[model samples]
Target: MLFDLTDLRLFIHIAESGSLTRAAERMHLSLGAASNRVKELESRFGMRLLYRENKGVQLSPAGEALLIHAQQFMQQLERMKSDMQQFSSGIKGHIRIFANTTAVTEFMPQVLGSFLARHPQVNVALEERLNADIVRGVAEGTADIGIAAGPVQGQGLEIINFSTDRLVLVTPREHALAGSGRIAFADTLAYAHVGLHEGSSLWHFLSRIVSQSGQRLELRIRVRSFEAMCLMIEADVGIGILPQSAALRHSQTMGLALVELDDPWAVRERSIVVQSLDALPHYARELVEEIRAGQAPRAISPDRNA
Candidate 1:
């Protein structure tokens, strides 16, 4: 027997809501109309689809079997519709992105601003996460794209080099090392260092540098965020090595000084990562090009100006 698509939709809705009354309310249909649809479906199949219970309606064995296939079919149909809409509208669709804190605060604004100006119809959603989490979001299909300090390891991910950023030592203006140019890593390590927690990417980068130099980093306090590290540095707790983007944003306004690290590992490559290189959507490709072509230079250091 042939069943209407609307009948399948109604069945799925009823199964989801677990009540004929609630399903009718959700579909904005009269209770009689909703009941008729379910009755018609059960009659056509020659089986009991639902059974009334004290808590709510429960799907019968036959109903449960049909519900699974119905839901999958509906999802695929919706995806197809969305794809056609995007193609017909010339790259107008919602694109969700995950970025690190430094990228969100400093780098992304200019790039996203320009893109939005050019493609006014497209909607963009952004979330700030840790570098590792950003990579995971893209890999897990939670985000369409991601921007991070370095390429994270995962199969089926296409990582393209977009830019480079440097880590700088930030201190209060009156600190003895404030005016110094390119402060040696050894000198900074001698003093108490305000840094992020050991597990953080920033901490890992610095730890690797110190380990290679045959010295252990002396940590005065471990903060969970770049903002907290800056605040502690401002309070003269210790010096901090923070992303240049983050450092420059607050250094001038907060009356803090930023110095370059002499260590070789101070600079990091920033990249745009996507799930699949072969099956990228048109808008995704455009966004990747925009990121690579429009990346800004790293924040200026005292030595560069002097």
Candidate 2:
């Protein structure tokens, strides 16, 4: 049976609003026209989709199924349109990448800037995601590439060592911990902490570790980006744990002191993940080569507190 996208969208609106009249108003259609469209959908499906109620409407069993598929269909279509818009704008290629927060905030800007400078026809869509989500997105073809730290496990994915980053604790120059050159993550929990906002990849990662450490992270406040967290720390709001590179970079302008974390997990070995290198488009393969060429061992300068 064939169902139109417009009708499917209307049905979704009706399902969400629980009122056909409201759905009609939202879709800019008359109530009668909306009712007829729903009726037409029911006729095409050969089954009752929604159960009319005095209050509004409820989805029948068949309606629930249709709603699930309709939402998926609409989402896929929207993604297609977004990808196609790049071409319409004279972009020759599009690449989607999902990576961990550190890579997103610390590493990708220079890499992407250089790559885009060399390939003006290419466009990239990058999202910061947790390591597990990055692996899954690459494996499911939701993203063309993924950059995440190690302990990554996924079938049919080619993993290449991308870079290494260390997590360090940053504090104001006069904070109690600022006198120490190295401290364990658990020890930092004793003081008020500045952290990335909840639902951020770093937030989730730190939460998991705190759970494992059998201690709670005493978060005084949460900010959106690493630089914001650093600013908060510099203001003596709270101590923060961030990638070493970021801490060192911010220390140049801010009076923040960096203290190395004793925990082994503090050091992360990031990797570039792809379903298949050879299977990627020519432009994608070139970008991959660019990323690979950019990989090099970085030497950490002495911590400020040291």
Candidate 3:
């Protein structure tokens, strides 16, 4: 016999209330109709679904299984309804957004929060990934939108200027290089460096820079975050590089010193990447436009394709 959603829902209601009378009131069905529905389900299954006792009714093994399936069915229906409503009034939507560490930790939060405030029915699931990974995600349709740091390494993607940040060298205030106003990244590599874990994009990016310069970075240790790296630097562990804002703020509190890097690549220009803006759904495009709106004129990504 074919079972319908109403059968499952009524079964769940009865299973929870343990009384047909109460379940009927909740479903607005008469007690007789509720009882008959349960009997029909039990007869079709060829087994008793509920065991009636003095205290209340309890699920038989078969009813327990049905309840599990019913809950899952209800959840799927909710998702279907939510997705369906987007077309008519944009009452609900889900967007897949990917970004690098800097964008995710610093800027994306505020931008997403503001967007969510304006569109309560829309939901976003964001992931922090390396720029390379983000590029791949956008191209392969794994992510609807991507925010990546400088020198994003793929073509065929529609790119827009997202934001700008600089990587500044941080050192102990009394360290020998502390007084240096501006230095090259290659020069900073001469000192033992405290950095993020090996897997982090910043670490990998720095490693690539040192490799390209034909010099070896003296990486002494790896920590988790900019603040943690700052703490290690405060202990005189080693020098490090961080975003300008993060470096300056932490240096003020921790007595660390910041130096501007002379390398042309030290200043990072981030971009928002998508396989094709025109291919995005209406709600996804809304999200993309909001992100574009938040950026200043200089930060607005240039048409990389142009």
Candidate 4:
């Protein structure tokens, strides 16, 4: 049998508060009105939903069953309302984004800050993962969008060029190479380097540069995160290569210095990956557009030196 939503709300409130008077106060209704509403609902269903006990109200067997269904129904209704508001307003839904550590720490703050300020109603959640994992999250629908450096190869996903970041060499302030504003590919390879673990996007990018230059880099240590690599460099364990933004952001606190990599291949493009551009929820699409447009002014020139 169909039940009125208002009656269900009153029943749930009474069940939650364990007192009819408390529920009436919460609902801004007189106690008599609340009692009459409950009585009418019970009469229609021909079953008592609550039993008065010494301490509080208790739900009967049928009340328990109806309560479960009512809660589920209310949750579904709330979800529907949220979805509809997002569709109509272009800004009122949860967007789950997966990004690499570099993007998460360096780039996303400005983009997200602006998006949130403009939308106000949108809620955003960010997950940090490696580049590959970010791509996987977007493909699997676990994340609404993925942002990272370099291209992601997968079917059924649209990759958009968002921005570009140069990979630079970082060294401790005391290192001989610290004063060099820009170092050639051969010079960087000559130093012992701290690098991301093999198979990471940064590692793969560095490998390509080494291969194209006909040399192999001497890696002193392999670590999982940019922060770890920076810590190692600061301790003078080894020099390292990382995104320029990461180097600049941590340079002061980490006691590290950054030098531009003169290698032509050191530049990398940051891209936004989505499962389907057209299929994204309204809020997600809006976020993607903001990121894309926000990078227009910072678009890397084809001339690497520029």
Best-fitting candidate, measured by lDDT?
2
Better of 3 and 4 by lDDT: 3
Model 3 RMSD, rounded to 1 decimal: 11.6
TM-score of each: 0.59, 0.82, 0.64, 0.56
lDDT of each: 0.79, 0.87, 0.79, 0.79
What tens-digit string does per-residue lDDT give for candidate 3 at 153-224? 667989988667788888887888887778888887679999998767787888888888788888889997
With a 3 Å backbone cut-off (N, CA, C), the pairs that clash in candidate 2 are: none
Off by over 4 Å in 4: 1-92, 113-125, 130-133, 153-156, 197-200, 207-216, 222-224, 293-306
Candidate 1 global TM-score: 0.59
Name the Cα RMSD for model 4.
12.0
Best model number under TM-score: 2
RMSD of each: 8.3, 3.2, 11.6, 12.0
So what's the TM-score on candidate 3? 0.64
Which digits, one per residue and each the tens of the lDDT, describe model 2 over residues 160-188?
88677788889998888888867988888
Is 1 or 3 the stronger prediction by TM-score? Answer: 3
Query: Residue 182: error of model 4 in Å?
Result: 3.1
In TM-score terms, candidate 2 sits at 0.82
